[model samples]
Target: MNIKLIHSKVNAVLKAASPITLPVDIESIAKKRGLDVLPYELGPDVSGLLAIKDGKGTIGYNSTETRVRRRFTIAHELGHYELHKEKSDLFVDKQFIYRSQNSPITVDHQIMEHEANYFASCILMPTDQVRKELEKMDIDLVSEEGIKHLAKVFEVSTTAMSLRIDKLGFF
Candidate 1:
């Protein structure tokens, strides 16, 4: 999948749902899309899953995970719902192993997972918002404290925020 295309798709969704406030609400967005967000005690390995039945969609995330993680999981499931729902009615996503940009995505499942991760990153830490936040802060992206502060502002895990910043070429 093309990274630019995924970014554009995320941008389109954001544009249609204009006036999105900071710390994007994953559950609210899912609800607006007519998808129910549910909490479930899924096993440790399973982060979340999406299911569409009878023309309705539901996203289930592991209740035991941290709030930030649950947020990302919901966004990831939303990605699958938006992009691959036509491919299958059910999508069960496990712990995502971060793949380097140059890694080979040879399988269909890997491709879809990669796209979903990209989608999650884009929506959770929008490029424009991130840039604006960085402009207001006088911290270095390479510093751990700076990453933590940014993560708190974005309501995401520090690791997720770091990856997002790196992907956006901020560091």
Candidate 2:
């Protein structure tokens, strides 16, 4: 997948979505894109899913997950709606795709997962915003407490913050 292209697409979506706030109003952005966001008591293995029916799209997140994880799940499903709609009308974002040997289809599925995750990270923890936030911090991001503080500010999990930092080349 072309990572740069995904970034560009997400930027455009953000522009159209407008007034992006911290922790992001993902539901509002999805609504602006003509998609509905919903909460569901999904099975343990499933985090989120995207469904398109009658020419309308809906994203559903597992309500049982922590707030941050649920947000990520929603964004992940939104990523599928934005980038993989042509690939499938429905996407089940489950825990894992069992490994398969030398399967092109498996590779494609993995690529899609990566793309969706990147999309979610970019939207939620935008590089510019992250930099701006970091500039205002006096704490060292290398420490667990520091990372957790930043995550709290972004309303994301510490794990998500760390991954985004690594992706942004901030380390």
Candidate 3:
């Protein structure tokens, strides 16, 4: 699946939903797509999983993770559902790691993982909204405090928000 196409699709969904709050309601979005988001005691290495059986799709995230991490995991599984469901009925995502945008993609699994990560980032931190938030704050992106504040506002981990800023070319 093309990362750009998935990003575009997510953007369209966000626009249609018109979320008016800080942390986007990703669970509601999943429910809208006929996905049941559930919490499970997955081990540390496993982040989340998406399973589709008998025309029913379910997303399960690690219940032991922090709320922010769980939110991202749910969004990531939703990405798999959006982009890779036609290819497979089951997807088990492990050890959440995002490849840099410039990194090489040498395998099909790498492609799917990268695309899902990008989808999660885009859905959680839309470019225009993040830019608007930064403009409103007038803060330095390089500063840790600024990143933390933005992360809190978006209800995402500092690492995730920082990566989104870098991907947006905010430096």
Candidate 4:
């Protein structure tokens, strides 16, 4: 899908839920959405997948990643569910997605990954609320610690927060 469509869907969800955050139990969300989420061993080449069978939906993640990383992975797959389910049967992300950002990949893959990242960020840190929270700080917006704090508040990795903040033109 197009960015506009993805943006609208994410934005609508954000508007409906004013403040979002990570460390969120995405498994619960999946269950609520009629999807089952299970932990399984995905090899080094793959991070996760959105699987559906017999009219049921599910997500599978690598067992080796840290809890925070697993949460992000689930959210990323959830992004595919909300935004790209109609286009592809699966989204097999690689390990160290931050590195993948610099690798040679197809434009379509890049776009989809970026959209999933965007969706993850918005779900983890609702822009409206983050803006309000940041108003109390007088520090440089792009500084390392500033981004780190944002990551802490959102319970996402520093890389994810930095990417989201950069995309928002906040620094």
Candidate 5:
């Protein structure tokens, strides 16, 4: 399917259901989705997974990741379900690199990654709300603690939160 089709379909889903925003809690979503969430030690092969068989959703992750990283991974996997699950029942995310938006990468990979990241950020911290929050703070307040708090509010990692903030032009 075309990217536009995928974007429209994803947006429709979000419109039909209230998207998760403030206090973005993945555990809550997992519980709501009837998923069994578990943690595994981080390693070279550490990644996130979601399987649906027999009418159940199961999500697994590397416990070694920081809370933020874990949240992003979970969110990314969730994106696959929301946007591409009918095509494949499973997804494995291996790397969690922090890259610039301009990084040279495959077009398709970059686009999907961008969308997943966008989905994660929007689900955790809707752009409108984040912009409003930024309006009340100084421009230079994107500190580690501040980012962490925003991530907590949005249920994402500091890295993801920072990227979102930057993308939203609040930085």
Candidate 6:
């Protein structure tokens, strides 16, 4: 699917809900959209599972993962719930995602994975919200230190924040 369309969809959801805030309440957002979010002692390799049956949706995330990772997992599952529910009612992310020599995934599966990932990124770190936060911070926005600090502020991983910065073309 188109990246811009993905972004717009995320933005629309954010706008229609309560005002955008730091450390987005992902679980609440999912719940607001009629999804049940829960923490489970999922398999070591599995990050999350999105299952929708009989019009009811549940998001199960790995409880052992870091708070940051769990947040992303929830958002990723929510992506599948929002964007791919029509195609299939289930999605599993490991590593937290699938793509291995042992169990190879088809191209279509790869595409869905990619889209869900992008959706997660957009939901968890909306571009406008990130830019607004950057403006309020006095630190150097391009440094590793700044990235780490922002990651904490956004409640996302440092790597995720770094990628967001790079993707926004601030390097």
Query: Model 6 over residues 20-131: C-alpha lDDT tens digits?
Result: 7888988999999999999999878999999999989999999999999999999989888878898888888876236465657777888888888788888888888888
lDDT per residue as tens, model 5, 64-144: 877777877776666666665665566556564325456555676566666665666666666667876666665355677
Ranking by lDDT: 1, 6, 3, 2, 4, 5
- Candidate 2 wrongly placed segments (more than 4 Å): 98-105
The per-prediction tally of clashing pairs is 0, 0, 0, 0, 1, 2
Backbone clash tally (model 3)? 0
38-148 per-residue lDDT for model 4 (tens digits): 888988767788875565668898888877688788878888788877777777777655345576767787788878867776666666656765786677768988887
**Model 2, span 1-171: residue lDDT tens:** 879878987899888877777878777888889998998988888888999997689998898998998888888888888888888898888774523355445778889988998899888888888998899989998899889988998889898899999988898
Q: Rank the candidates by TM-score, best first.
A: 6, 2, 1, 3, 4, 5
> Candidate 3's residue-wise lDDT over 124-162, tens digit each?
888888988998886677899899999998999999999
Please give the RMSD to the true structure for each candidate, in Å. Answer: 3.0, 2.3, 3.3, 3.1, 4.5, 1.7
- Per-model CA lDDT versus the true structure: 0.87, 0.85, 0.85, 0.73, 0.65, 0.86
Pairwise TM-score winner, candidates 1 and 5: 1
Minimal lDDT window, size 10, model 1? 96-105
lDDT of candidate 2 at residue 170, scale 0 to 100: 91
TM-score of 4: 0.79
Clashing pairs in 1: none
lDDT of 5 at 2: 49
Top TM-score: which candidate number? 6
- Model 4: residues with Cα > 4 Å off, grouped in runs: 14-25, 96-106
Which prediction has more favorable TM-score, 1 or 4?
A: 1
> What's the distance in Å from true for residue 41, model 6?
0.9
Residue lDDT tens for model 1, 79-166: 9887888888998876643344554434787889889988998998999999999999987778999999999998999989989999
